[model samples]
Target: MYVFGDSLVDNGNNNFLRSIAKSNYYPYGIDSNRGTATGKFSNGDTFVDYLGAWLGLPAPPPFADPTTTGPRILGGVNYASAAAGILDETGQHYGERYSLSQQVINFETTLSQLRTMMSGPNLSRYLSKAIAVVVLGSNDYINNYLLPGLYPTSFNYNPTQFANLLLNHYARQLVALYSVGLRKFVLAGLGPLGCIPNQRATGQGPPGRCVDYVNQILGPFNQGLLSLVDALNNGSHPGSIFVYGNSYAAMGDILNNPARYGFRVVDRGCCGFGQQITCLPWMPPCFDRTQYVFWDAFHPTQAVDAVLAHRAYAGPPSDCHPINVQQLALINFL
Candidate 1:
């Protein structure tokens, strides 16, 4: 898989850059097989990691990693970066990050390297079978438009207009990926941003309740994205299959019925104080991590990641629209 988007899917790509949005530290990978952090922002693996294993492929290496050269390219490369967004200026506060456009440019570099090993039909066939997983846009709201003090987006455009701006740019970027030979895509929509610990702790809602205003703003973007999926598949790109992963509904199910998913803590994270800040380095996380929905103020725990991955992999239409990842994998449009 060729992964894109923000920290939700980022697995060490930000570590290589001079960015504060990094998680290559203690207590981060406390549940991994090695119990050593490899820059994934969770107690164990991200959903993308689980999805990779489900597909029988090794976790794609970070594109910026020094070892991501030669034969390693065959396993795919992860270009996801923490704090990244659809807009170029979205995460400037965090220093360096690969925006969607920059990630595609980096993919072009990867494609150039692949051409050295395979050309024409071989390269096209290889790319056609690969899945391009894009889970972006949250940062555009969390890091950019919402930060009215740092950005003028809120002053310029309303929520609906901002979402449209994001979708317009995103559509162009996806088409760019298609032009480069990617035939399969998993376009995950934005989730309930208001329900996260950071937003909940802002004192914008009733005690222990989600910030409904924040969640309401994301509806237009998610609905428009589902429409974009239909737009792309209906002959916009021949043989291309773009599936919409409904992250909003998938996460909402877990939040609404935490007990059903074996989660005890729904309003806070297992590590930090469940405030605005993230978990500190070497901080001791909860021993019963499986009982918590969030790992940090913003990211979900490995347990939650596992559930979301399972849903996207084979769940019904409520989780993955049109077709699940398993169905996408079975298709050979080439």
Candidate 2:
């Protein structure tokens, strides 16, 4: 599958790129079995890594790797980068960061190279069977709209206008990909940003309470995304499309009932003291990461990633239906 978007989906693109938004160094993946940093924002494996394993394909390679060649092209590659978003200016206010458009351009370049290595039939089969998984837009809100005084002041765009702009651009990009050979798609919407450790630390809510404003923006984003997917799959787009996953509700469920998911701590992160500043820093290390749902301030722990991936591929209970990634996977989109 072609995995695209930001750090949430990035396996190690930031490691290759010379940027501060990188995690390919010490203490990042020190807890991993390999003992070497793998470029994932989290401690060990990511949700996409588990997804690739479930699909019976080798974990997708990072697109930034210049040395990758041959049969590795069959499974797919990840073009995601840290701080990338649906628009060129999505995260620019933060600093130097790759935009989502640039990531897609990288994806186009990778596909061009892959075409030279595969036979005609192989190429057709690969596109026919492949799935494009896209997870993005969180950083745009966190870094661009909320952090920087862009939307609330400079542009005067509220959450709704900003979300519409993001979705519209994202739709155009997806449509462009459809014009190419990409048929199957799995578009993942943004997860609950308000409930994340970072936001919780900054906000005044109780440990378990989700911030209302963040949820307010996320609801419309997911709704618009779902509507767009439905419109695309209605015979206008080629092949088939699926939602792939619903990270928001699933994460909230795990947080609300940590015992059910074998987690001990949902409020405090496994790393740092769950404080606003230290959670995003590199100095203070988190203590027993496996026991907590969140590894750092923004990302999920390896254990939670594993469970979320399993549920995404194997289906969740009825109450979560269309919101479940597993059920979305079973839609027979291929």
Scored by lDDT, the top model is: 1
Q: What lDDT score is found at residue 220 in candidate 1? A: 87
Candidate 2 local distance difference test against the native: 0.73
- lDDT of candidate model 1 versus the reference: 0.92
Q: Which candidate is the best by TM-score?
A: 1
Q: Write the per-residue lDDT of candidate 1 for residues 71-188, one digit (tens) a residue.
A: 9989899999999999999989999999999999999999999999997899999999999999999999999988999999999999999989999999999999999899999999
Q: For model 1, what is the error of residue 150's alpha carbon versus the real structure, in angstroms, after optimal superposition? A: 0.8
**TM per prediction:** 0.99, 0.89
Writing each residue's lDDT as its tens digit, candidate 2 over 183-259 gives 76777767778887778876656656777777777777777887887788677765666463677777878888999
Off by over 4 Å in 2: 93-95, 150-155, 204-208, 277-284, 316-334
